[model samples]
Target: MDLKSTVASIVDWPIEGVIFRDLTTLMKNPEALRESCDIFYERYKDKNIDKVVGIDARGFVFGAVLAYKLGVGFIPVRKKGKLPADTIEESYSLEYGSGTLEMHKDSLDVGDKVVIVDDLIATGGTAGATVNLVKKLGAEIVECAFLIELPDLKGRERLNGCKMFAMMEFDGE
Candidate 1:
Protein backbone atom coordinates (compact mmCIF):
# COMPACT_ATOMS: atom_id res chain seq x y z
CA MET A 1 0.00 0.00 0.00
CA ASP A 2 1.14 3.55 -0.75
CA LEU A 3 1.04 4.56 2.88
CA LYS A 4 2.31 8.02 2.15
CA SER A 5 -0.91 8.90 0.33
CA THR A 6 -2.83 8.18 3.51
CA VAL A 7 -0.71 10.64 5.52
CA ALA A 8 -1.69 14.24 5.91
CA SER A 9 0.79 17.07 6.35
CA ILE A 10 0.03 20.05 8.52
CA VAL A 11 2.25 23.08 8.34
CA ASP A 12 3.28 24.92 11.51
CA TRP A 13 1.37 22.72 13.84
CA PRO A 14 1.88 22.96 17.63
CA ILE A 15 4.70 25.33 16.58
CA GLU A 16 5.71 27.45 13.67
CA GLY A 17 8.30 26.67 11.03
CA VAL A 18 7.52 22.97 11.27
CA ILE A 19 5.42 20.73 9.08
CA PHE A 20 3.97 17.75 10.84
CA ARG A 21 3.28 14.60 8.81
CA ASP A 22 0.33 13.15 10.59
CA LEU A 23 -0.37 9.44 10.31
CA THR A 24 -3.88 9.32 11.76
CA THR A 25 -5.27 9.12 8.25
CA LEU A 26 -3.13 6.16 7.44
CA MET A 27 -3.92 4.56 10.77
CA LYS A 28 -7.63 4.76 10.14
CA ASN A 29 -7.40 2.92 6.85
CA PRO A 30 -7.49 -0.75 7.71
CA GLU A 31 -5.39 -1.77 4.70
CA ALA A 32 -2.74 0.81 5.42
CA LEU A 33 -2.65 -0.03 9.10
CA ARG A 34 -2.39 -3.72 8.46
CA GLU A 35 0.32 -3.20 5.89
CA SER A 36 2.25 -1.06 8.30
CA CYS A 37 2.15 -3.69 10.99
CA ASP A 38 2.91 -6.43 8.52
CA ILE A 39 6.04 -4.63 7.41
CA PHE A 40 7.40 -4.44 10.95
CA TYR A 41 6.39 -7.97 11.80
CA GLU A 42 8.13 -9.34 8.73
CA ARG A 43 11.44 -7.77 9.66
CA TYR A 44 11.48 -8.77 13.32
CA LYS A 45 9.67 -12.08 13.21
CA ASP A 46 12.97 -13.91 12.97
CA LYS A 47 15.06 -11.51 15.01
CA ASN A 48 14.14 -13.32 18.21
CA ILE A 49 13.07 -10.11 19.87
CA ASP A 50 12.33 -10.53 23.56
CA LYS A 51 10.42 -7.27 23.88
CA VAL A 52 8.94 -4.40 21.90
CA VAL A 53 9.36 -1.03 23.62
CA GLY A 54 7.33 1.90 22.35
CA ILE A 55 7.57 5.55 23.18
CA ASP A 56 4.55 7.21 24.71
CA ALA A 57 1.26 8.03 22.94
CA ARG A 58 1.45 7.34 19.23
CA GLY A 59 4.15 4.75 19.53
CA PHE A 60 1.83 2.60 21.56
CA VAL A 61 -0.42 2.12 18.53
CA PHE A 62 2.18 0.31 16.51
CA GLY A 63 4.42 -1.19 19.16
CA ALA A 64 1.85 -3.16 21.10
CA VAL A 65 0.42 -4.99 18.10
CA LEU A 66 3.83 -5.73 16.69
CA ALA A 67 4.77 -7.31 20.00
CA TYR A 68 1.67 -9.47 19.84
CA LYS A 69 2.39 -10.66 16.31
CA LEU A 70 5.94 -11.43 17.30
CA GLY A 71 4.61 -13.32 20.30
CA VAL A 72 6.80 -11.31 22.65
CA GLY A 73 6.23 -8.70 25.33
CA PHE A 74 5.34 -5.04 25.02
CA ILE A 75 6.69 -2.21 27.17
CA PRO A 76 5.83 1.46 27.04
CA VAL A 77 8.39 4.16 27.74
CA ARG A 78 6.16 7.00 28.78
CA LYS A 79 6.52 10.61 29.83
CA LYS A 80 7.80 11.29 33.33
CA GLY A 81 5.47 10.18 36.16
CA LYS A 82 3.24 8.36 33.71
CA LEU A 83 4.21 4.90 34.82
CA PRO A 84 3.30 3.69 38.30
CA ALA A 85 5.53 1.63 40.55
CA ASP A 86 9.31 2.08 40.65
CA THR A 87 10.62 3.31 37.31
CA ILE A 88 13.83 4.38 35.66
CA GLU A 89 13.78 7.58 33.61
CA GLU A 90 16.01 9.41 31.17
CA SER A 91 16.05 13.06 30.20
CA TYR A 92 16.82 14.27 26.70
CA SER A 93 16.89 17.41 24.61
CA LEU A 94 14.11 18.33 22.21
CA GLU A 95 13.77 20.94 19.49
CA TYR A 96 12.10 23.33 21.87
CA GLY A 97 13.50 22.33 25.22
CA SER A 98 13.89 19.04 27.10
CA GLY A 99 11.70 16.24 28.37
CA THR A 100 11.91 13.13 30.55
CA LEU A 101 10.78 9.59 29.71
CA GLU A 102 10.38 6.67 32.02
CA MET A 103 10.06 2.92 31.90
CA HIS A 104 9.33 0.42 34.62
CA LYS A 105 12.55 -0.65 36.35
CA ASP A 106 11.64 -4.29 36.18
CA SER A 107 10.35 -4.40 32.62
CA LEU A 108 13.60 -5.65 31.17
CA ASP A 109 16.43 -8.00 32.01
CA VAL A 110 20.10 -8.34 31.26
CA GLY A 111 20.95 -9.52 27.75
CA ASP A 112 17.33 -9.46 26.61
CA LYS A 113 16.96 -8.50 22.95
CA VAL A 114 14.59 -5.63 22.28
CA VAL A 115 13.19 -3.66 19.36
CA ILE A 116 12.10 -0.06 19.88
CA VAL A 117 9.14 1.23 17.87
CA ASP A 118 7.68 4.66 17.37
CA ASP A 119 5.24 6.36 15.00
CA LEU A 120 7.90 8.58 13.52
CA ILE A 121 11.54 9.59 13.87
CA ALA A 122 11.85 13.35 13.73
CA THR A 123 14.69 14.68 15.86
CA GLY A 124 15.24 11.24 17.37
CA GLY A 125 15.37 12.71 20.86
CA THR A 126 12.57 10.58 22.27
CA ALA A 127 13.74 7.46 20.50
CA GLY A 128 17.32 7.96 21.59
CA ALA A 129 16.26 8.57 25.15
CA THR A 130 14.25 5.35 25.08
CA VAL A 131 17.30 3.54 23.76
CA ASN A 132 19.37 4.77 26.70
CA LEU A 133 16.74 3.60 29.15
CA VAL A 134 16.81 0.16 27.55
CA LYS A 135 20.59 0.11 27.75
CA LYS A 136 20.49 0.74 31.48
CA LEU A 137 19.00 -2.73 31.76
CA GLY A 138 21.82 -4.12 29.60
CA ALA A 139 19.34 -5.24 26.92
CA GLU A 140 20.67 -5.75 23.43
CA ILE A 141 18.89 -3.47 20.97
CA VAL A 142 17.84 -5.46 17.96
CA GLU A 143 16.85 -2.32 16.07
CA CYS A 144 14.72 0.82 16.14
CA ALA A 145 11.67 0.77 13.86
CA PHE A 146 9.51 3.59 12.62
CA LEU A 147 6.75 4.06 10.08
CA ILE A 148 8.07 7.38 8.85
CA GLU A 149 11.40 9.19 8.93
CA LEU A 150 12.22 12.83 8.25
CA PRO A 151 15.80 12.71 7.07
CA ASP A 152 16.39 16.45 6.91
CA LEU A 153 16.43 16.65 10.71
CA LYS A 154 19.43 14.36 11.07
CA GLY A 155 17.51 12.35 13.66
CA ARG A 156 19.41 9.20 12.84
CA GLU A 157 22.65 10.79 13.95
CA ARG A 158 21.44 10.76 17.53
CA LEU A 159 20.48 7.11 17.06
CA ASN A 160 24.09 5.99 16.72
CA GLY A 161 24.99 2.46 17.87
CA CYS A 162 21.52 1.18 17.04
CA LYS A 163 20.20 -0.19 13.78
CA MET A 164 17.08 1.60 12.52
CA PHE A 165 14.35 0.79 10.01
CA ALA A 166 11.66 3.04 8.60
CA MET A 167 8.88 2.14 6.19
CA MET A 168 9.21 5.40 4.34
CA GLU A 169 11.27 8.58 4.36
CA PHE A 170 9.95 12.11 3.78
CA ASP A 171 12.50 14.66 2.76
CA GLY A 172 12.04 18.32 1.84
CA GLU A 173 8.47 18.20 2.95
Candidate 2:
Protein backbone atom coordinates (compact mmCIF):
# COMPACT_ATOMS: atom_id res chain seq x y z
CA MET A 1 0.00 0.00 0.00
CA ASP A 2 3.07 2.26 -0.07
CA LEU A 3 2.37 3.28 3.49
CA LYS A 4 5.59 5.27 3.69
CA SER A 5 4.40 7.64 0.98
CA THR A 6 1.28 8.36 3.01
CA VAL A 7 3.35 9.51 5.98
CA ALA A 8 4.23 13.18 6.20
CA SER A 9 7.83 14.22 6.70
CA ILE A 10 8.30 16.90 9.31
CA VAL A 11 11.69 18.55 9.49
CA ASP A 12 13.15 19.54 12.85
CA TRP A 13 10.18 18.17 14.71
CA PRO A 14 10.42 17.97 18.51
CA ILE A 15 14.10 18.93 18.11
CA GLU A 16 16.60 20.33 15.65
CA GLY A 17 18.16 18.13 12.95
CA VAL A 18 15.46 15.52 13.54
CA ILE A 19 12.88 14.66 10.89
CA PHE A 20 9.73 13.14 12.21
CA ARG A 21 7.82 10.53 10.26
CA ASP A 22 4.28 11.50 11.09
CA LEU A 23 1.75 8.71 10.79
CA THR A 24 -1.26 10.98 11.11
CA THR A 25 -1.54 11.20 7.37
CA LEU A 26 -1.34 7.46 6.86
CA MET A 27 -3.65 6.75 9.80
CA LYS A 28 -6.23 9.16 8.43
CA ASN A 29 -6.47 7.17 5.24
CA PRO A 30 -8.75 4.18 5.79
CA GLU A 31 -7.25 2.01 3.09
CA ALA A 32 -3.69 2.44 4.22
CA LEU A 33 -4.55 1.95 7.87
CA ARG A 34 -6.54 -1.18 7.20
CA GLU A 35 -3.90 -2.65 4.98
CA SER A 36 -1.19 -1.94 7.49
CA CYS A 37 -3.11 -3.57 10.30
CA ASP A 38 -4.05 -6.51 8.14
CA ILE A 39 -0.44 -7.10 7.25
CA PHE A 40 0.58 -7.18 10.91
CA TYR A 41 -2.31 -9.40 11.88
CA GLU A 42 -1.66 -11.89 9.14
CA ARG A 43 2.00 -12.17 10.02
CA TYR A 44 1.53 -12.82 13.75
CA LYS A 45 -1.86 -14.50 13.85
CA ASP A 46 -0.28 -17.90 14.28
CA LYS A 47 2.39 -16.86 16.75
CA ASN A 48 0.21 -17.63 19.78
CA ILE A 49 0.73 -14.29 21.42
CA ASP A 50 -0.92 -14.32 24.85
CA LYS A 51 -0.76 -10.56 25.21
CA VAL A 52 0.04 -7.57 23.04
CA VAL A 53 2.07 -4.97 24.93
CA GLY A 54 1.76 -1.48 23.57
CA ILE A 55 4.16 1.29 24.57
CA ASP A 56 2.19 4.35 25.41
CA ALA A 57 0.08 6.80 23.45
CA ARG A 58 0.38 5.85 19.80
CA GLY A 59 1.14 2.19 20.46
CA PHE A 60 -2.24 1.90 22.12
CA VAL A 61 -3.91 2.89 18.87
CA PHE A 62 -2.93 -0.22 16.92
CA GLY A 63 -1.99 -2.47 19.84
CA ALA A 64 -5.49 -2.66 21.28
CA VAL A 65 -7.04 -3.27 17.90
CA LEU A 66 -4.38 -5.82 17.01
CA ALA A 67 -4.96 -7.70 20.25
CA TYR A 68 -8.68 -7.79 19.60
CA LYS A 69 -8.11 -9.02 16.08
CA LEU A 70 -5.91 -11.82 17.38
CA GLY A 71 -8.21 -12.68 20.28
CA VAL A 72 -5.63 -11.76 22.92
CA GLY A 73 -5.44 -9.28 25.75
CA PHE A 74 -3.77 -5.88 25.42
CA ILE A 75 -1.25 -4.76 28.03
CA PRO A 76 -0.26 -1.14 28.09
CA VAL A 77 3.36 -0.16 28.74
CA ARG A 78 2.84 3.39 29.88
CA LYS A 79 4.78 6.15 31.51
CA LYS A 80 5.22 5.79 35.28
CA GLY A 81 2.03 6.07 37.42
CA LYS A 82 -0.38 5.77 34.53
CA LEU A 83 -1.57 2.31 35.49
CA PRO A 84 -3.90 2.10 38.49
CA ALA A 85 -2.75 -1.22 39.86
CA ASP A 86 0.62 -2.43 41.09
CA THR A 87 3.09 -2.03 38.29
CA ILE A 88 6.62 -2.91 37.31
CA GLU A 89 8.73 -0.06 36.04
CA GLU A 90 11.96 0.22 34.11
CA SER A 91 14.07 3.26 33.31
CA TYR A 92 16.06 3.49 30.11
CA SER A 93 18.16 5.98 28.20
CA LEU A 94 16.60 8.24 25.62
CA GLU A 95 18.21 10.22 22.84
CA TYR A 96 18.80 13.07 25.27
CA GLY A 97 18.87 11.32 28.61
CA SER A 98 16.53 8.85 30.35
CA GLY A 99 12.84 7.95 30.75
CA THR A 100 10.75 5.36 32.51
CA LEU A 101 7.90 3.05 31.53
CA GLU A 102 5.58 0.80 33.52
CA MET A 103 3.26 -2.12 33.07
CA HIS A 104 0.82 -3.78 35.42
CA LYS A 105 2.63 -6.16 37.74
CA ASP A 106 0.21 -8.97 37.01
CA SER A 107 -0.32 -8.24 33.35
CA LEU A 108 1.37 -11.45 32.27
CA ASP A 109 1.78 -14.87 33.77
CA VAL A 110 4.90 -17.01 33.77
CA GLY A 111 5.70 -18.31 30.29
CA ASP A 112 3.06 -16.09 28.66
CA LYS A 113 4.10 -15.10 25.15
CA VAL A 114 3.92 -11.42 24.30
CA VAL A 115 4.39 -9.21 21.30
CA ILE A 116 5.39 -5.57 21.88
CA VAL A 117 3.89 -3.03 19.53
CA ASP A 118 4.61 0.62 18.88
CA ASP A 119 4.07 3.21 16.16
CA LEU A 120 7.76 3.42 15.36
CA ILE A 121 11.24 2.25 16.35
CA ALA A 122 13.84 4.95 16.74
CA THR A 123 16.96 4.24 18.83
CA GLY A 124 15.51 1.09 20.48
CA GLY A 125 15.76 2.41 24.03
CA THR A 126 12.01 2.34 24.60
CA ALA A 127 11.54 -1.07 23.07
CA GLY A 128 14.48 -2.47 25.00
CA ALA A 129 13.03 -1.15 28.24
CA THR A 130 9.65 -2.61 27.44
CA VAL A 131 11.24 -5.96 26.70
CA ASN A 132 12.99 -5.95 30.04
CA LEU A 133 9.73 -5.14 31.83
CA VAL A 134 8.00 -8.03 30.11
CA LYS A 135 10.79 -10.40 31.07
CA LYS A 136 10.76 -9.25 34.68
CA LEU A 137 7.08 -10.17 34.81
CA GLY A 138 8.11 -13.72 33.84
CA ALA A 139 6.60 -13.45 30.37
CA GLU A 140 8.47 -14.23 27.16
CA ILE A 141 8.52 -11.73 24.33
CA VAL A 142 7.85 -13.52 21.07
CA GLU A 143 8.29 -10.56 18.78
CA CYS A 144 8.31 -6.79 18.44
CA ALA A 145 6.28 -4.96 15.80
CA PHE A 146 6.24 -1.39 14.60
CA LEU A 147 4.74 0.66 11.81
CA ILE A 148 7.98 2.35 10.89
CA GLU A 149 11.67 1.82 11.59
CA LEU A 150 14.55 4.29 11.30
CA PRO A 151 17.21 1.85 10.15
CA ASP A 152 20.03 4.34 10.46
CA LEU A 153 19.57 4.45 14.20
CA LYS A 154 20.00 0.66 14.39
CA GLY A 155 17.08 0.35 16.77
CA ARG A 156 16.97 -3.33 16.02
CA GLU A 157 20.40 -3.78 17.57
CA ARG A 158 19.01 -3.13 21.02
CA LEU A 159 16.64 -6.02 20.39
CA ASN A 160 19.32 -8.61 19.82
CA GLY A 161 18.04 -12.23 19.79
CA CYS A 162 14.42 -11.09 19.70
CA LYS A 163 12.30 -11.44 16.58
CA MET A 164 11.31 -8.03 15.23
CA PHE A 165 9.16 -6.84 12.35
CA ALA A 166 8.16 -3.52 10.84
CA MET A 167 6.08 -2.37 7.90
CA MET A 168 8.42 0.32 6.63
CA GLU A 169 12.01 1.49 7.01
CA PHE A 170 13.64 4.88 6.44
CA ASP A 171 17.13 6.33 6.64
CA GLY A 172 16.89 10.08 6.59
CA GLU A 173 17.49 13.38 8.27
Candidate 3:
Protein backbone atom coordinates (compact mmCIF):
# COMPACT_ATOMS: atom_id res chain seq x y z
CA MET A 1 0.00 0.00 0.00
CA ASP A 2 1.09 3.55 -0.76
CA LEU A 3 0.99 4.95 2.78
CA LYS A 4 1.88 8.41 1.54
CA SER A 5 -1.30 8.63 -0.52
CA THR A 6 -3.31 7.57 2.50
CA VAL A 7 -1.88 10.53 4.41
CA ALA A 8 -3.72 13.79 3.87
CA SER A 9 -1.57 16.76 3.04
CA ILE A 10 -2.70 19.98 4.67
CA VAL A 11 -1.12 23.09 3.24
CA ASP A 12 0.01 25.78 5.65
CA TRP A 13 -1.16 23.77 8.60
CA PRO A 14 -0.25 24.66 12.23
CA ILE A 15 1.60 27.58 10.62
CA GLU A 16 2.30 29.22 7.31
CA GLY A 17 4.86 27.50 5.06
CA VAL A 18 4.38 24.22 6.97
CA ILE A 19 2.76 21.26 5.28
CA PHE A 20 1.34 18.82 7.78
CA ARG A 21 1.13 15.20 6.71
CA ASP A 22 -1.90 14.15 8.68
CA LEU A 23 -2.01 10.44 9.55
CA THR A 24 -5.65 10.37 10.56
CA THR A 25 -6.56 9.63 6.98
CA LEU A 26 -4.15 6.75 6.77
CA MET A 27 -5.15 5.48 10.21
CA LYS A 28 -8.81 5.38 9.22
CA ASN A 29 -8.14 2.91 6.43
CA PRO A 30 -8.09 -0.59 7.91
CA GLU A 31 -5.70 -2.12 5.43
CA ALA A 32 -3.19 0.72 5.51
CA LEU A 33 -3.14 0.85 9.29
CA ARG A 34 -2.80 -2.90 9.61
CA GLU A 35 -0.05 -3.07 7.03
CA SER A 36 1.87 -0.28 8.68
CA CYS A 37 1.72 -2.02 12.05
CA ASP A 38 2.60 -5.35 10.51
CA ILE A 39 5.66 -3.84 8.87
CA PHE A 40 6.96 -2.49 12.16
CA TYR A 41 6.23 -5.73 13.98
CA GLU A 42 7.98 -7.84 11.35
CA ARG A 43 11.01 -5.58 11.27
CA TYR A 44 11.59 -5.41 15.04
CA LYS A 45 10.36 -8.77 16.23
CA ASP A 46 13.85 -10.04 16.82
CA LYS A 47 15.30 -6.86 18.35
CA ASN A 48 14.79 -7.93 22.00
CA ILE A 49 12.70 -4.91 22.84
CA ASP A 50 11.73 -4.76 26.53
CA LYS A 51 9.50 -1.74 26.13
CA VAL A 52 7.97 0.44 23.43
CA VAL A 53 7.95 4.10 24.41
CA GLY A 54 5.53 6.15 22.37
CA ILE A 55 5.59 9.90 22.03
CA ASP A 56 2.51 11.83 22.86
CA ALA A 57 -0.57 12.13 20.62
CA ARG A 58 -0.12 10.26 17.34
CA GLY A 59 2.49 7.82 18.52
CA PHE A 60 0.04 6.33 20.97
CA VAL A 61 -2.11 5.01 18.13
CA PHE A 62 0.42 2.50 16.83
CA GLY A 63 2.82 2.16 19.76
CA ALA A 64 0.38 0.47 22.10
CA VAL A 65 -0.65 -2.04 19.48
CA LEU A 66 2.92 -2.70 18.46
CA ALA A 67 3.92 -3.34 22.07
CA TYR A 68 1.02 -5.71 22.50
CA LYS A 69 1.95 -7.59 19.36
CA LEU A 70 5.54 -7.87 20.54
CA GLY A 71 4.42 -8.96 24.02
CA VAL A 72 6.27 -6.07 25.59
CA GLY A 73 5.30 -3.18 27.85
CA PHE A 74 4.02 0.09 26.35
CA ILE A 75 5.35 3.23 27.99
CA PRO A 76 4.08 6.70 27.19
CA VAL A 77 6.24 9.78 26.80
CA ARG A 78 3.69 12.52 26.99
CA LYS A 79 3.63 16.30 26.89
CA LYS A 80 4.42 18.17 30.11
CA GLY A 81 2.32 17.03 33.07
CA LYS A 82 0.13 14.75 30.95
CA LEU A 83 1.09 11.73 32.99
CA PRO A 84 -0.54 11.73 36.42
CA ALA A 85 2.19 10.08 38.46
CA ASP A 86 5.59 11.44 39.40
CA THR A 87 7.38 12.20 36.15
CA ILE A 88 10.71 13.16 34.76
CA GLU A 89 10.73 15.99 32.23
CA GLU A 90 13.02 16.94 29.36
CA SER A 91 12.83 20.26 27.55
CA TYR A 92 14.21 20.58 24.05
CA SER A 93 14.54 23.12 21.26
CA LEU A 94 11.83 23.63 18.68
CA GLU A 95 11.85 25.71 15.48
CA TYR A 96 10.39 28.67 17.35
CA GLY A 97 11.15 28.10 21.00
CA SER A 98 11.29 25.13 23.36
CA GLY A 99 8.86 22.39 24.31
CA THR A 100 8.80 19.92 27.16
CA LEU A 101 8.02 16.20 27.28
CA GLU A 102 7.54 13.98 30.27
CA MET A 103 7.61 10.34 31.19
CA HIS A 104 6.76 8.52 34.36
CA LYS A 105 9.78 8.05 36.61
CA ASP A 106 9.05 4.34 36.92
CA SER A 107 8.32 3.71 33.26
CA LEU A 108 11.41 1.66 32.61
CA ASP A 109 13.98 -0.28 34.55
CA VAL A 110 17.67 0.42 34.37
CA GLY A 111 19.26 -1.33 31.38
CA ASP A 112 15.90 -2.07 29.80
CA LYS A 113 15.91 -1.99 26.03
CA VAL A 114 13.49 0.69 24.79
CA VAL A 115 12.27 1.71 21.37
CA ILE A 116 10.79 5.16 20.80
CA VAL A 117 7.98 5.59 18.32
CA ASP A 118 6.38 8.58 16.67
CA ASP A 119 4.22 9.33 13.66
CA LEU A 120 6.82 11.39 11.81
CA ILE A 121 10.39 12.62 12.02
CA ALA A 122 10.45 16.18 10.70
CA THR A 123 13.39 17.76 12.55
CA GLY A 124 14.31 15.01 15.06
CA GLY A 125 14.18 17.47 17.95
CA THR A 126 11.44 15.60 19.78
CA ALA A 127 12.98 12.21 19.13
CA GLY A 128 16.35 13.34 20.43
CA ALA A 129 14.78 14.70 23.59
CA THR A 130 12.92 11.45 24.13
CA VAL A 131 16.17 9.58 23.78
CA ASN A 132 17.73 11.80 26.38
CA LEU A 133 14.88 11.10 28.75
CA VAL A 134 15.33 7.39 28.25
CA LYS A 135 19.04 7.71 28.92
CA LYS A 136 18.43 9.76 32.05
CA LEU A 137 16.27 6.94 33.31
CA GLY A 138 19.13 4.52 32.58
CA ALA A 139 17.36 2.60 29.87
CA GLU A 140 19.14 1.36 26.79
CA ILE A 141 17.70 3.00 23.69
CA VAL A 142 17.51 0.22 21.14
CA GLU A 143 16.12 2.35 18.32
CA CYS A 144 13.76 5.08 17.20
CA ALA A 145 11.01 4.36 14.67
CA PHE A 146 8.65 6.50 12.67
CA LEU A 147 6.04 6.11 10.00
CA ILE A 148 7.30 8.96 7.80
CA GLU A 149 10.48 10.96 7.43
CA LEU A 150 11.16 14.35 5.84
CA PRO A 151 14.57 13.69 4.36
CA ASP A 152 15.31 17.23 3.22
CA LEU A 153 15.21 18.46 6.80
CA LYS A 154 18.12 16.20 7.72
CA GLY A 155 16.44 15.23 10.96
CA ARG A 156 18.60 12.14 11.16
CA GLU A 157 21.65 14.29 11.85
CA ARG A 158 20.43 15.10 15.35
CA LEU A 159 20.16 11.38 16.07
CA ASN A 160 23.82 10.50 15.65
CA GLY A 161 24.81 7.06 17.01
CA CYS A 162 21.20 6.07 17.39
CA LYS A 163 19.46 3.48 15.25
CA MET A 164 16.61 5.14 13.32
CA PHE A 165 13.97 3.64 11.08
CA ALA A 166 11.19 5.12 9.00
CA MET A 167 8.67 3.36 6.79
CA MET A 168 8.38 6.11 4.18
CA GLU A 169 10.31 9.17 3.06
CA PHE A 170 9.51 12.43 1.28
CA ASP A 171 12.22 14.66 -0.11
CA GLY A 172 10.33 17.80 -1.03
CA GLU A 173 8.43 20.05 1.30
Q: How many Å off is the CA of 146 in candidate 2?
A: 0.6
Against the true structure, what is each candidate's TM-score?
Answer: 0.97, 0.96, 0.95
Query: At residue 20, what lDDT does model 2 achieve?
Result: 85
lDDT of 1: 0.92
Off by over 4 Å in 3: none
TM-score computed on alpha carbons, candidate 1: 0.97
Residue range 1-173, candidate 3, lDDT tens digits: 88888988898877888778899999999999999999889988999999999998888988998999999999999989788999999887754357999999999999999889999988888888898889989999888999999887777777756899999987675
lDDT of 3 at 20: 81
lDDT of each: 0.92, 0.89, 0.88
Q: What is the lDDT of residue 84 in candidate 1?
A: 85
lDDT of 2 by residue, 76-103 (tens): 9999878899988999885545789999
In terms of TM-score, how similar is model 2 to the real structure?
A: 0.96
Total clashing pairs in model 3: 0
Error of 2 at 123 (Å): 0.4
**How high is the lDDT of residue 108 in model 3?**
94
Query: Which window of ten consecutive residues has the lowest lDDT sum in model 2?
Result: 90-99
Screening candidate 2 with a backbone cut-off below 3 angstroms (N, C-alpha, C), the clashing residue pairs are none
